[model samples]
Target: PRAAAAEHADQLFAGLQDPALYRFIAEAPPTDVEALRARYTRLATRRSPDGRQAWLNWAIWSFAEEAYVGYVQATVEAGEADIAYVVFQDYWGRGYARKAVAEMMGLLREAHGVAGFRATVDTRNHRSRALLEALGFECVAIHADAEVIHGRSPTRPSIG
Candidate 1:
């Protein structure tokens, strides 16, 4: 789905309760399914309240596994999309996050006129930083004791 929906609250909320998933981030799991439903209901709008930015969220469903792995999201403004994503702890090292994020960036550029992409990865998450680099994102700035902000243009470079 293009946006988080209340209907997926139960399934998604279950994956979110894994404490290991929050090891590098500050957010704790939602207290209950109802809270997740409420949050998703608001996110379903897919637009910031003031309308200056577009909120794009997609739930990841795996056919082979018959489960919801996680999600990818972006906030877009002025031709740049700020990206974020997650792949539940159990699905780690399977390349799901990389694939999902690449697809999201492609859709944003082709359908939404997004020319650039950006992300802030927690400094301690070395795998995430490496993944972004593999996606052609260059680290543009770093927040001390926090995240490293990176950016990438839509067009990847050709082989030399």
Candidate 2:
């Protein structure tokens, strides 16, 4: 399922606080902690009309602090799942996202009994595309105008 801009905004702001930090990859301006918290709480506790969760999201905190630097949002598709992620600006340019993604993939493979994972990257997002490729994902194709690069993760070798 697709998420609302407000929900994504709330999470993006909360994950990357400082004005200087928020400017890196976000499309919106920075937000104060209070506004960020309120919106986050609302979105976090929000339930669908059917009484089910709004959307599934997960976070990876920064060390022992409540502060977070990485998180993932996934949607179920054809009995499988597709994931997307964002890392804080302070942590950008580092290999943290790659490391975190690798760990998440391992956990998902075990817990979900999944055979593969997939991601779509903007053509201009070289860094993200590279990270995906480094994780064993191959570019499957480019969507119209090459705006999106679809890639898939390989299945782990089976053990005897």
Model 1 poorest ten-residue lDDT run: 151-160
- Residue 25, model 2, lDDT: 42
Off by over 4 Å in 1: 154-160
Report RMSD (Å) for each prediction in the order shown. 2.8, 6.3
Query: Residues 1-160, candidate 1, lDDT per residue (tens digit)?
Result: 3457898888899899999888777789999999989988888898999999998889988777788999999999999898998889999888878888888888888889998888887888989887888888888777875665556664742221
| Residue 155 shift from truth in candidate 1, angstroms | 3.3
Best by TM-score: 1
The number of clashing residue pairs in model 2 is 0
Taking all chains together, each candidate's TM-score versus the true structure is 0.91, 0.61
Candidate 1, 128: how far from true, in Å?
0.6
Quality of model 2 by C-alpha lDDT? 0.57
What residue pairs clash in candidate 1, if any at all? Answer: none
